[model samples]
Target: MKLATLTLAATLVTGAAFAAEIAPSDVQFDEYGAVDQSLTGTPGNPEEGEKIMTNRGLGNCVACHEVSALDYAAFQGNVGPSLDGVADRWNEAELRGILVNAKKTYDGTVMPSYYRVDGFVRPGNAYTGKAADDSFGPLLTAQQVEDVVAFLGTLEYEE
Candidate 1:
């Protein structure tokens, strides 16, 4: 009985620790729509970021942008500009802002705001706005957004 109780306690503590890691969804943008703050107050892992950016069930950045560093990915779309040398074009905060909400940076952009929750039309429901059963939330976690930013920062011109 003591062992079971100890295990349960450990699980709860660990779960809480992980839950606290997620950054706040209320993001603040600059005049240029750049997020100048770190979402997690810690540097993200570039390797993990790369995985999240390419994963179809996750960031799925390849669906609209082509990343030369991710040439292994198939059927990369061109709707957005190439991210080959994005690191040279934008700073870390700018990259973070773009990921958090591209529409804030470039109006009329089809990019989905990955971390925004408020100001959404008929939020807290499915995308079709017909199903109230599905609870809509930030597409990616705070840590995931930081991770993608770290990865994008590495996409400098290779030439």
Candidate 2:
């Protein structure tokens, strides 16, 4: 009985320690899954997107996917496919959906949701946004996601 009680207590403590909550207002997507709607009407700035991807504290996309353009990016993650020619493979809508939540299209994928504000494990400390007690918020704002997508579009297969 004592062991069981100790185990349960440990579980609760661990869960709370990792349970970094998102801002109550941060829940942007009413739809928990694939976002079909184009969040941004205006085209995003590819240059800005590139910066976010490179920023370790922000998107830090290079941590998971390889991008040749970011030649100086260090410790590129090898889990996801390379982003060399992603534009050829997916359109803007498709890209947007993936950016919002890749799990909607490809379930069981390791890719984290860029715009999603829900369903996170160890979201880490609240990095940005206005929230109480430093609770976390969306990894990237809607505009940021669009910008990253724009930059990704610049990557195309060379003949």
Most TM-score-accurate candidate = 1
- Model 1: per-residue Cα lDDT over 52-158, one tens digit each: 98999999999999998898999999999999999999999999999999988999998988887656666444554432124557788888999999999999997
TM-score of every candidate relative to the true structure: 0.77, 0.68
- All models: lDDT? 0.83, 0.73
- List clash counts for every candidate, in order: 0, 0
Q: Report the C-alpha displacement of residue 145, candidate 2, in angstroms.
A: 0.4
| lDDT tens digits, residue span 1-159, model 2 | 999999999878766643543332333333544344445544579999999999989899899899987889988888989998899988776777788778877889989877766455554455434343445456787778879888988989988
Error of 1 at 159 (Å): 3.5
Provide the lowest-lDDT 10-residue window in model 1. Answer: 124-133
Model 2 segments beyond 4 Å from truth? 1-36, 121-135
lDDT of 2: 0.73
Model 2, residue 104: distance off in Å is 0.4
Off by over 4 Å in 1: 1-25, 122-134
